[model samples]
Target: MKYSLQDLIDMEHFQQKLIAVISKSGLKRLTEIEHRKQIEKSENRYRSILKASLDGYWLTDTKGKLLEVNDAYCRMSGYSEKELLSMYISDFEIIETPELVAQHMKKVALKGSDRFESKHRRKDGTVFDVEVSLQFRPEEGGQCVCFLRDITDRKSLQDRLESLWSLAQMTEAGPKVLFNLVLEKTQELTGSRYSFFGFINDAEDQLEVNAWSKEAMNQCRVQDQPIHFPIAKAGLWSQAVLERKPLFWNDYNLDHSRKKGLPDGHVPIKNFLSVPILRNEKVIALAAVANKDSDYTSQDVSQVQAFVSNILLLIEKRIADEALQKSDERLKLALDSVSDAVWDWRVHTGEVYFSSRWYTMLGYEAYQLPQNFETWRSLLHPDDLPESEATVFRHLKYAEPFEIEYRMRTKENQWRWILARGKAVERNDQGKAVRMLGTHMDITERKQSEMAQYPCQHPSNWYFNKYQR
Candidate 1:
């Protein structure tokens, strides 16, 4: 239609405005498409990564309803993907308390994450342990993603390691202390209700139950019984000792093939494991476990073998060390009981060592005494020094037995007569004296008594002198 000049301009302007609106609409569409593609790519990558991950992945709503689960999750539960998704997360929980789950969720809500370990039931009605770590995304409508890992094997290994560690700590204690520890550790490791440890008395040639776990010792009626076989015979303990290896018996009572030598009135033995305590290839003790809750496996046997071996070594070392300590104490006591003062000399160095008693008998303590030949020379009387030094030098130079008479200062600072006697007890390969051990006898009283008894002769000569008088 024909219009005014103003109307024409308005129409042109409207046309330009419509073109701009169309261009803007096209750009908006392109942006929307790019955004959608980006979202899809991110989702696909997330799904791929979740499925390929070693840990099981699961998503649940705030109500704990299972929304989705990865293949790993389904596999862990022994269920198909569809089945897991159809089931609520609460359905798999061994604990039915919703309050606990809610509390955990609250923690996750506050911190955005939570982690715990709990028992989970599988599709096959079996139970397995799982460690779960959950992260919450409130922006995603309070959705939670949980990562679950099967830790049954890890838990079992941890338990076994703990048992072994307990055994080791127990064995570190002395034998008398370890007796009960060994029995208890064996029972715990083997899951046995009863266990006993018997040591063979080398002198008596009899077996004695030195230690037993709680009820095992009480239930075991045989103690101090002669070890016989087939009838009141030595059980697994004897067998292990003879074999020097581990023995496992599943259903000892039911196994007709097993020879029965159980004592009368004794409880029937069920599953049993036995190991020997060997020292220097000889079986010194026997450890036996019985009435296990389950059949003993090769793993149990191996663990018991290791346990027994360690126990044996510990016992052997403990006994040897104790004996050595006892012998050393006895020697020390003997040395202390003697009247003479013992001394040790390093010949090559010409250093002298004296016991505490020797130093105390003199006017000094052991540390206060001079440790070299010069110290001894300083202590010697001027008159006796020449004779003593001459005697010692002659003996040392010729490698002969040493004997000398010297004077020493008493605790009262009085001179006392001492007879020193020594011999080279140790020598080097070149026959040179390395060590000289000796003793010093306080002969002052003896010498004075002899001098006081002057003019006394033997009985026959005394009778002749008496008759002449």
Candidate 2:
């Protein structure tokens, strides 16, 4: 059997042998044939891989004019294959300019590759985010190949994550302010005219709006006040709360059989989404967005889920902090209303907060006394320092009740008897004293009275008699 030249060339066997044939021919014609075959094989391989990619791919020149495009790119750009071939990369880059491209090319030249995020315009003029990874193909006339992935959803998720991080860092913000921040960030995310995050009233029948977007307040609230309603209503958010799941509606006006209608002064809505903020498998709060220019989607619900988690965390922290602060205030008030001087010391840091009574008891104005451990130590008579320090160390180490008598120097530079009484008020995880609260009472008059009643037995009587001389 004989084989024709074309048949032999078409066979896979002949193609494999072409590698050897080209090298042996060493002539320009055979070399060109080999080169053409190699180019065809490369193109086939490129098309098979790049066209099948989920991301778009584009090959362009240094001037940005498109040299080639994969099927995905043509679909993404909303352009036909022929039309895209005639366009420049700039035509689709909504946020990038010639100068930016030039700068990007410079980096690509130095690094041989670069990746960045930018917005791209489709043929119909809508814009979305894209992450482009560009590689320089130096072999081909300053050509560059780009791998493009649509990152609109990823960018939105990242923005929500960043908002969460910012809110987490703002632990000092008041609860009201933090709630408003949640609404604002969510409003921007959903592109809604109104956003609401609120909890159910104790009755479980009323949903109280804790936070509302400014637009929601103006349009839906009563006189710029929060707007909430009975859970009995069949509104989108109410249904979400009752069902304990997310609900989305694109056209509420079209529904006639729904159990609820728009409330008085409520903003008219084209579309809305509502999701439950559940804790321990129970609905604790509801997050809702309404009157978005576009329709509400399931994607919007998922996005708000992330926001809701962060919001709940911040709210829980704020509530705990507020309770602690109130408790602190009550304790301080109880200590302050007394006639005795008070001092609360943070044992770990050596910081002291002295009450105003402490200054007045020593015959000085409130501002005259310094709030420091060293200041307290300086006011102690040198004779009292050793016993006072020893008592404090024993009390801190053993949780022993601290009650001792010491001579404290007054503002007049006179030694006065004081009953120093205190106990460790707080402790660290290792059972070490971290805070201590105590009181100082001026006992000079009592000591003098005792000395008069029993002059022989009182230790200070001889000193008193010597001073009298």
- List the candidates' TM-scores in order: 0.60, 0.76
Q: Lowest lDDT 10-mer window, candidate 1?
A: 459-468
What TM-score would candidate 1 get against the native? 0.60
Tens-digit lDDT track for model 2 on 1-469? 8989878778867777897787677777778989999999998997889988889988888888888888887788789989999988777787879777777777786788888889988887656789999998787668788999989889988888898888878888888987888788777888788887888765668888887778766665445453576787645568777777898888877764443766667777777888888877777788888877667777788888888778778888889989999998887778668989899999988999888788878778885867889888998877779989999999999987799998776786666788999999898899999999999998888988988888888765665565434
List per-prediction Cα lDDT, in the order shown. Answer: 0.73, 0.81
In model 1, residue pairs whose N, Cα or C atoms come closer than 3 Å (at least 3 residues apart or on different chains), thus clashing, are: 228-233
Query: Which candidate leads in TM-score?
Result: 2
Candidate 1 — what's its lDDT? 0.73
Q: Residues 1-469, candidate 1: write the lDDT tens digits.
A: 7899999999999999999999899889999999999999999999999998889998988778788888887888899988887887668888746767777677788898888889888887666689999989886679898999999768766766786677567544788777776777777666778877777665324567677677854665775744322312544445555555777778675544335457765767767887766666665677778886557777667666666666666777888888998997787568767778888789788787776667766767655767776777777777778988887767766866687777765555567778999887887888777887889888766665664576353222332233223
State which candidate has the highest lDDT. 2
